[model samples]
Structure formats: C-alpha cells, structure tokens
Target: MTSSVLEAQKLGRKYGRRWALRDCTIEIPSGHVVGLVGPNGAGKTTLLKLASGQLEATEGAVTVLGDRPAATPARLARIGFVAQDTPVYSGLSIADHLRLGARLNPRWDAAMAQERIARLGLAPDQRAGKLSGGQRAQVALTLGLAKRPELLILDEPVAALDPLARREFMQGLMEATVEHEFSVVLSSHLVSDLERVCDFLVVLVDSRVQVAGETDKLLATHYRLTGPRRDTDRLPADQQVISASHTDRQSTFVVRTDSPIHDPAWTVTQLNLEDLVLAYMDKHTADRRAALEVQR
Candidate 1:
C-alpha cells in the first residue's frame, strides 16, 4: 500500500468575493506519477502553487512530508517544482543555469545534471534566452530532476512544446520515474498526455475535487448504462447516477458502484479516461444550468 506524501484538509483559496478553490481535500501518495487536470479557469495551477508552497491557502491546511509546506526548509529541499511557462533566467546560458542550480540547491547532483544535458543533446553554452521554447523547458526539467527530490511537481510542463518535443519530454519523465523511486505530479489540460504517462489522476472541476484515486480502479469501477427512458422515479434505488441523457424510449447514464450489476434490460459499457473526464465535466455543466434556472 502506498503512503501519502502530501495531504490537504478543507483546502481553499479566495480572492475578494470569488473562491478560487474551496473545500478541496486530497491525499497524494508517494512514488507514483499523478496527473492534475481541469479546464481553463479551473484552479489547477492554484492547487499546484499551494502544494509547492508558492501560494498560501485561504483556509484549512496542507502538509508536505507531514510538515507544513511553508518554511519547512528540509521538506522544501526534498521537493522540486517546474512551474508553468518553464521559468528560466533569460540571459543565462544552459551551463550557467546548471551551475546556479548546483550552487543553490543543497542536494544538487552535478553528474546527474550533466548526464541529462548529454541525453537531451543540448549544447551547454547555448543561452537559455536563445534556445527555442521547447529547449528551455528541457533545461528547466533537467534542473528539477537533478535536485534529487523525493517529490517533483510540474505545472503544464509540456503545454508549449511541439508534438515531437512533447513526446520526448514525456518519455524522459517516464524513464526518470522507472530509474529512480521519486514521485511526480504534473498538471496539463491535454488529456492524451495524462492517459499516456499517469497511473493516478486527480480531476478538479470548478475549483473543487471531482475525483482522486488509482487510475485503473476509476476506469474499472465506472460504467455507462443504457435502458428504457424513465423519469427520476424509475431509476433503481441502488444505482448512483453520475450523469444522464435520455430520449422517450431510452436513457443512458454514467454510474459508480463496486457491486456487480446484472440487469437484463440495461447495457453497460466501460469508460475510457477521456470518456470519464467528459462525464464529470458534463455533471458540472448540468449543475450550472440548474443553478441558473433556480435564479430565474
């Protein structure tokens, strides 16, 4: 069984009257790759920032390595973060960045950094500002990986890369995970990337945690069921409808349960990661509609 490396309780963030994130509770286990996902304006970045200690939560608490994320020097040293936009010193050369990381980070591994640079085929003297967008991202990743962190976090690390570069970056990440025992959490709007690299997923929509769990269990337990159309009065008491669509003679639904379903008239189909995400997004869409109707 995997033990949690990070835990949050009633986590929330607010700006004026707007709640950027609210009632967000999640447990992140160690030594596995996790994907953090949601649409634009969904607070994915905010959550990552809080987890990395860059932003403070408005309420509740978050702990890293069982210590508060803020000002825990030892804990901070054990975590690595590659923020969105792949931030780097514009005027610094690739070698300069590597040297700076080695000097500043207490646990930096020089040999590991050099090996990564060689693997990526990057020229050490090239100025970071002079490299292409994707190359800069690679440099940032190299810096992150060489720190020998117990937990690594990347916020939309591949959003700016071309298809080939993106694939290469993901490949490198996979190789690192297998070669070492460190855990990683990456944020991306691209579902395809998550499908390819992650064994665990945390889906956040509307600044709230919609689901967080093992990827296989989520895919295996959730199903879409279709049967004769009926109003709310006709659904089986045991069926937990996640989302629904209907016509006069037929109704389709996404439901969750651990019990085996054996209804003769209902056809059940398994959902892929993309389908599951879409179903949850649809649930939020319907909820918004209902709220607007109430206002009217």
Candidate 2:
C-alpha cells in the first residue's frame, strides 16, 4: 500500500465568522497528479495555502509527510508552491530570481533550472517584468520544478498562458513528474488541462469539499441516469442523489453509488470531468437555496 504524503483531518480556516475551508479532509498519496477544481471563491486558494504551509489551519489538523505542516522546516522544504498570481519580483531579472532561489533553498538543483531556462529560450539577464505573460509563467514553473520538492502545489499556473502556452506548460509538468518522483496538486479552472495530466481530483465548492478521490474511481462511481419519473423512495439508500431533474414523462439524475446497474430501463451515461464537477456545484447551489428558504 502506498503511503500518504499529505493528510488533512477535519481541516479548516476561518476569517472572522466566514469559513474559507470547512471540515476539509483528504489524504493525498505520493507520486500522483491531483487536479484541484473549483469556481471562483470556492476556497481553492485557501486550501492550497493551508496545504503548502503558507497559512495555519484555524481548526483541526494537517500533516505533511507525517509531520505538522508548520513544525518541520525540512518538511516545508519538501513542498513547493506556485501561488495564484505566480509571484515573481518585477525588479529582479530571471537569472537573479534563479540565483536567489538556489541560494535560499537547500534542495535547489541549479543544473536542472539552467537547463529548463535554456530550453525555454529565456535569457538570464532578462527582467521578469519585461517577459511576456507566458514566459513569466514558464519562469515561475521552472523555479518550482527545480526545487525538487516531494509535493508541488500550483494554483492556476496556466491561467495566464494562451492555449499553446498552456499545453507547453502542462507538458513541462508531465516531464518533471516523470523524471522526478513527487506528488503534485494543481488547481485550474480549465477542465481540459486537468483531464490531460491528472489521475486524481478534488472538487471544492462554497468553501467545502464536494468531492475528492481517484479520478477514475470517481468517474466509475458516478453515473448519469435518465428514465421515466418514479418515486425517489425506490432508490436505494446507498445511492446518493447528486442532482435530479424531472419532466412529465422523463427524469434525469446524476447519482453516486457503489452498486452496479445493468438494467435497460435506466440509460446510464458517462460523465466528463467538467460535468462531474458542475453536478456537485449545482447540488451545493440547490442546498443553499433550501437553507435560505428554511431561514425565511
């Protein structure tokens, strides 16, 4: 059995009275690519911050490689984070940034960093601010990769790049993960990027984790069922209704269950990664509506 590199137990962070992440629990094993998916204000950033040890959990606990996230500097060094904006000092040149990272980080690999920069055709003396958006993102990624961290977390790393650049950036990540043994968790709004590179997924909505699991396992467990309307009471307790819609003669439902269905009456269809996430988001929205009505 593979060991988990990171684990969160009822982890959470609150700002004043609002919870940024509430009861978010997940175990991420090593050597897997995890795709973090969520819409804006879903606390994706907050979760990443907590996991990266950049922010302390307000309640519960989080462990990085069997140690408290903040307890071990060595463990913290084992993780690399590319934040939402992909921060790079504008005043510093590309080479200056690399040099600083090499000097500051104990695990920085100079040869690997240099090779990546050369491959990208980035000049050492070029100011980061002078580079194009795509180039700047590439520089940030190069720095993160060269750190040789056991866990790499990227927040919207490709959001600034164009389609071609995004593809290239993901390819770079793939190569890094293949050549190096490490676990990666990257957040992106682009489902296509996640589909191409990640085998694991975590979906967050409204400051709560809606789903988290192996990508294939999730896809296998969830199904789109369409058939004539029937009493929901007939559905087994194990089958969790994620979202449901009904017309006079037809009913469609997205459900998650462990049971297998081979019946002909219900047409079972596969769901793509994007549709799967949206189903959870829609369910959350509906639940919120019901809560507001109750308060009224």
Candidate 3:
C-alpha cells in the first residue's frame, strides 16, 4: 500500500560495544525484489532483523509498509520473515507446521498452503526433520507465503542448499512473488543468485550501506575504466572512484558518474551487477584499510 516497502533513516543496532549495523539508511520502493548483498558481518542480517521487528534499533528508525515494523498484530500480519537456515521444528510434521501457522496468523490461507505443499510433492505427514534442506526451506517459504503478507523478508534462505536446490528454491520464490504480487527483501552472499532474482540492489559493508539503487541504474552509471597509469587525483572530480588498482604502465578504476566519459586516453566498459556490487564493497574495504594505516 505504501510507496516504499521498507524505509530506514540512520538505522543502527548495537550489541554492547559492537555495532552490527550503523547509519544504514535505505528506502526500498514497493513492487520490487530487492537484493541485500554484502560480505560476512556486513550487517545484512541485522538490518533484516530490524526490518522484521525481531530486534530493535539502537539509533534512528525503520518503517515497514508505512508503519513502525510489527507495531501491532495487524501490522505484524502484513510482514512475513523467513530467517536464515529456514528454521522449522524438526519434530513437527509438514501438516503440523501449516496448522501452527493457521493458528498464529489470522490471515493465513490454509487452502493455499495445502495446495502449495501438494504441488511441491511434499507429504503432509512428512516430518520436517526427515526432509532435505531444500524441502525444509520450501516448507518455511510456504508458511511465509501463505500468511499473504504485503512484504516478505528472507535472509539467506538457500545458503545451505546445493547448486540445484538453491536454483529450485529461488525459482519457486520468484514464481510465488509473481503470483502473490508482494514486495520482497532478500539478503544473500551469492551475488550471482541475487543478480538473477533481484531488480533492485543494496550493498552493505562494514556496518554501513555502501550503495543502493535499481540494478539497471547502478550498472549503467558505474563504469570500469582502464588507462595509462595515473593517480586518482588526476581524474575528473565528477567521476567518484569506487575502487582502483594500478600497475607500472596501466591503471583501472571503477567509478560512478552520470556524465559520459569522452576522454580518449581511457577505455570505459559497463559493469555487471556482481561487479558493481563488488566494486562498492571493495571500496569500503579499501577505505577502512586506508583509515587504519593513517592511525598506525
């Protein structure tokens, strides 16, 4: 219903002395499958938890579907979260899980749940513990989808699955999204997976958002330029370098700029989604290293 599915402003979460997420501000617009990609400990999970109301922010604020996340029963019903490892009760049968979901969620669609389970060829009597990792993930995803939430958040749902299983899980998810017409925020380390499924992208690193935008726009604006070796200071100010490397005879830089590069000395090429995300991530790491060196 809102223009944005998830909105955060200076959002941060601290665990005693350590900050899991800091100064993360992003507005994920509605009707898009957003990919949240970053390396380990980049605060992707922390941000997802805050959005799903599993954890409170230590600073700033976050809103989901135009209201404070999970502020009330009604609001909670509108947002579904499938956490890492696709958690499920090993002792419970698939039917039991559906029953539990129905009992807890007022908007739960029992028929749809049953239908999905049958379509997946999973027996209602099958114990979650007996199911494969991929099957368990599917069961969890079914629960989330049956709730009929306006927004669904998945944190590395397929991280433990094999290649084929991971593809299957993602395919099923995309199909469900198309059918249900809900917004999604998915976090994963597999950039290639994200590239396949996500229309919008968010790159988080070192407890901060390095960049966030539509995938097409990000790829279009960011370019990889290679030319004769030169200091970054010599490049135009408009070309904000995200990451750079130099050899004795040549230099390469990833930069973000709206303007065209007409300089004859440099060769510019477009970057893929994975490259774009990595460029931002590499830039963050480089900046941190530079700061630490200065301190030393």
Which candidate number maximizes TM-score?
Answer: 3
> Which residue pairs of candidate 2 clash?
none
RMSD of 1: 1.9
Alpha carbon lDDT of each predicted model: 0.86, 0.87, 0.92
- Candidate 2: tens digits of C-alpha lDDT, residues 39-108: 8878888888898889989998888767777736687678898987678999999999999989878999
Residue-by-residue lDDT tens digits, candidate 3, 213-239 = 988889889999999999999999999
Models 1 onward score TM values of 0.93, 0.92, 0.95
Ranking by TM-score: 3, 1, 2
Q: Which is superior by TM-score, 1 or 2?
A: 1
The weakest ten consecutive residues by lDDT in model 1 span: 230-239
- Estimate candidate 2's alpha-carbon lDDT, on a 0 to 1 scale: 0.87
What's the TM for model 2? 0.92
Which residue ranges in model 3 land beyond 4 Å of their true spot? none
For residue 172, what is the lDDT in candidate 3? Answer: 90
